[model samples]
Target: MKTWSSIILAGGMSRRMGSSKALLEINVQTMVELLVEVLTPFSRKIIIVSNEKDYEYISSLFQQALHVQIVTDDPLYQGEGPLAGIYTGMKELQDSWYFVCACDMVKLHPNYLVGLQERLHTEIVTKRQQYDAFIPYSEGRVQPLAGLYSQQKETIKKLLDQNKHRITEWLTHMNYYRIEPSEWQGWTPISDVFFNMNKPEDYLQICRERGK
Candidate 1:
């Protein structure tokens, strides 16, 4: 298995949820904790990007998980959105590839991730293509956070430098391999893996679905 690093974007204000979604409990685990658990087995390092105020609290929460690191948004890109958080993680690890996701994601399918890794290997090693990212496109939308990225720290920096915080816009400037819905639909229901809670109602809905 190739080495991989993971980045969890948890810096959002959670205005709609009225609280920190990262701290929300699901199946007896905090959102970030569950995400860390999922990534720990496959990741060499897992970075949680949040505000500086959350550094100590998040660090304490993951004390037993030594491989996990918590970081504040880069000063220049504070509150810039998921794109900035992604860039911060890329800078910290400087790894060849990254598996990025949002803190509110309730279920992450490991089988799908494995498939993405295999696809990435084929493109970069077998086919000798220079793709900057491997992202999933589902439900007529591009899921940038639930995607794998190449070492495009510089490219991201350029975007942030230009005050461009939109992830989709960043993709346009790079050579990316997009996994369409047709490619991933058979493995599992895409909605389950990509489910994210953006509001209190969404959280309640997840709780209901999970029989919590």
Candidate 2:
């Protein structure tokens, strides 16, 4: 019911995967393409933040199929990490709420994301100033990328200005609502939804799952 924008952080070095994970495929579609498809219905705008070199390659794949805006990290914050990607996206888009995701996530659950948006909107209507972010917590770790951020431009900029680019560190200073894994039990298994491909083994695992 709440309209928001989405930012896919595909700028990772992927050193562990030894290749661009965004380009990795599931059923012949790149990871970025699949993520864009999953997010298109929920987002008013979709932004893909990637490195300059990979921008062209990624664009070539989706420029025609989807109406997405692909951008490189701000020159000022190049190579700063996912926090910089979030800052760049929030600064570029006018949306008050943003759903940030990592490109490595192969099985994104739309229901889970929609549920987060619902929770965020409910809080906005009831306790507006209580939270700036709605993130998920699973296996005792907060999933920053798979979260929604609100009015984050200035706050994120402050962190970037201070040279503090860690997302977890930045979260400590904001009023954030954490959605526990228990909250998503009915929609899908937490492990399947949050599984991110960081290495060859992880990718292979997803491939094997798909074959089942």
Q: Which candidate leads in TM-score?
A: 1
Report lDDT per candidate: 0.85, 0.85
TM per candidate comes to 0.94, 0.93
For residues 82-191, write the lDDT of model 2, one tens digit per residue. 99999889888778888999999898988777777678768878875677888888777998888888867888788888999999889988888888877765545555
Worst 10 residues of 2 by lDDT: 183-192
Least lDDT summed over 10 consecutive residues: which range in candidate 1?
183-192
Q: Local error of candidate 1 at 140, Å?
A: 0.9
Those runs of model 1 whose alpha carbons end farther than 4 Å from true positions after fitting are none
lDDT score, candidate 2, position 77: 92
Residue pairs that clash (backbone atoms under 3 angstroms), model 1: none
Runs off by more than 4 Å, candidate 2: none
